[model samples]
Target: MNTAVSQQPDAGVLLELDGIGISFGGLRAVDDLSFKIRRGEIVGLIGPNGAGKTTVFNMITGVYRPTDGRIRWHGRDITGLAPHRIAEAGIRRTFQTIRLFQDMTVLENVIAGQHLKMRQSWWQGLLNTPAQRREERELVEHAMEVLQKLDLADVAHEIATSLPYGAQRRVEMARTLVAKPELIILDEPAAGLNEQESAGLNDTIRAIRDAGITVILVEHDMSVVMNVTDNIVVINFGKKIAEGKPAEIRSNPLVIEAYLGQDDEEEDDPLLNAVHDQVNA
Candidate 1:
């Protein structure tokens, strides 16, 4: 059941997962999942609860190693690299639940994310060498620039957890951006956002892609997934079920069945109804 991407990745391809799978105990959490992300494209990975969406993100970011298959980035094999090495390789991610340094100021949190990119060694930092001092100054400047872009500059000095929920989410994104990632994996970013905030987040995602960073997101919000992503990959029980454009996915029987179930009465479910409205609108 190898579902790996068939052809060799072209120059535009930024990531490729070939027949990747992982298990816990005797249960296979993710089985033979594969997908490709092109440079500068926003790809949405969507599925029902327990579909192993976040598990895929875990594998890609090195939080967990796949028991089978390969992960390639820029045509280089990085299947089981350490998390720090993965980040160093230009991949960064956000969690479904915001993982921010609650006690740290918005600016400081972003600066923390830039630690890997900093050239200062432990000794240099301990001694506060001239180069270390210079790097610190540059890091602050870069963090501020990222905050400004995310519209969080005004709250740069505010504590991370003290901000409003939407602002807090933006802070997390700002932190990830400070890492200068080539591919950003956002796990359920729209989860707790209001309609207005979700819309704004959608715009922010597009802006990130426009800036030449590739994005792969796992989200349950159909509207955001439909509006923001250039392509959609659907999974069910850990295996890929459907992959296509928004319009195609909206009308896909497999996706519709997976989300809304096959029951005739469930066909009018709110999520499916909204999908229909969006497709028509």
Candidate 2:
């Protein structure tokens, strides 16, 4: 990881992955990978398919604990915290697949994302106390505000899973944003959208950043990655190969070779085979 340039001592780093790695059985899925994310910046984590991008996301979000290295949240050692605990600690993430509530209205679905921050206890909800009602009203107001920001307010009362695919993606993002996380990890948010929808996504992501939330975006769309990110961290076979501004990453010989090289199938086969054997072992 050539990251000396990326790790500034004075940069307001919100998250740090120090030599983080994970393995499956005996197969190393991710090696010693590291990067620093400054607060309020959109950082792109990109590589070819099967580059362990989502594995890194899983480790950061506590779906998978790292076999090596430390993960720090705002200078606190948060390695191996349970997923709910991590979410409570002001970190949230979206999945590659949209996970909206099937039957809930869009506003209701987004309001649910704030459960970790809900002040009313279960007993209060059970009792339908005045305080609980007040809290509910406040949360509903905030969720609608977030939906307006995501351009989904018009559909706030629509069934969430019934919206168009692009709108569903925005709903998932609206759900994440409603939580007010300090850092949001988006896993391929633009995966199924057309060009216009992708363009809308770019604006939405920038709005999130401008609101002072640091973002770690794992995306395959080059236009989105190149147009939106403040910095890019490139990986292949689970190792950090490049980290810099998008323009710099765009021209780097190593990154170009990794993405455009003719022999990638052969190059990636060894690690692919190792993971396959591990899964079947």
Candidate 3:
């Protein structure tokens, strides 16, 4: 409902959500939200549970159409495009739940993500034409290169699900990278990772931005969000509450109140206290 933080023009914004909103029956999951993600920056979308974070991702990826407003990719309106079409348009995402092909090898799973970019048709693939063979070779090489970038090439042939949980997370990232998207949306990427694993993941995310991909990171882990993100947009009850750099967000009274509530007991709670410690450190 607040348009104050809705728009801030940037010269090279890769993705723009202009007054986006969505509802399910009587509940408004996201209400007239707006934000812009500049190319090559890691922007964190953070909030308390049920804060419409994932709902925004769903709308951007076309998993759910916005009830109002437009989603633009490089200034082109792409609202309501099918999910596959969105992927083909150079927007890819990883889920909160790992979605790797359990039976497939790590390399195979990454290669599968390149389907939209593959030029060979089904018929050509069925016949195993020379061109198809060549393309397949190239695909393997490309997938391996992505795996190498993410430090997962050593386990390239292992069953995807057989790796350690952190490594498996890297596999999912490798899979998304193979698609060569302009924007990558990760939903709670550090969900199951321990502290050490989360630290490593933070490096991997920085690497992703260094690779020239803009990232919209939806995460609940305040430490990861605060440490890794270049900018943060905070929301609550389906509305934008705050948006700024990590330092500003860390000190914002609105953000502190949103997460800690207004009770004296809550002010001294572990979660809020940890947040204060991180922000001040």
Evaluate all candidate structures by whole-model CA lDDT and list the values in order: 0.87, 0.86, 0.88
| Number of colliding residue pairs in model 2 | 0
Per residue, candidate 1 scores C-alpha lDDT tens digits across 141-204 of: 9999989888999999999999989899999998999999999999889878999999999988
Ranked by lDDT, the better of candidates 1 and 3 is 3
- What local lDDT score does residue 201 receive in model 1, on the 0 to 100 scale? 93
Model 2 lDDT tens row, 58-124: 9999999998998887777788888998898889999999998889999989998888889999999
Q: Name the candidate, 2 or 3, with the larger TM-score value.
A: 3
Maximum-lDDT candidate: 3
**Candidate 1 off by > 4 Å:** 1-8, 262-281
Model 2 poorest ten-residue lDDT run: 1-10
lDDT (10s digit) by residue, model 3, range 27-106 = 99999999899987899998776788999999999999999998888777888888998998899999999999979999
Pull out the clashing pairs in model 1.
none
lDDT of 3: 0.88
- How displaced is residue 49 in candidate 2, in Å? 1.1
TM-score of each: 0.91, 0.89, 0.92
Off by over 4 Å in 2: 1-11, 262-281
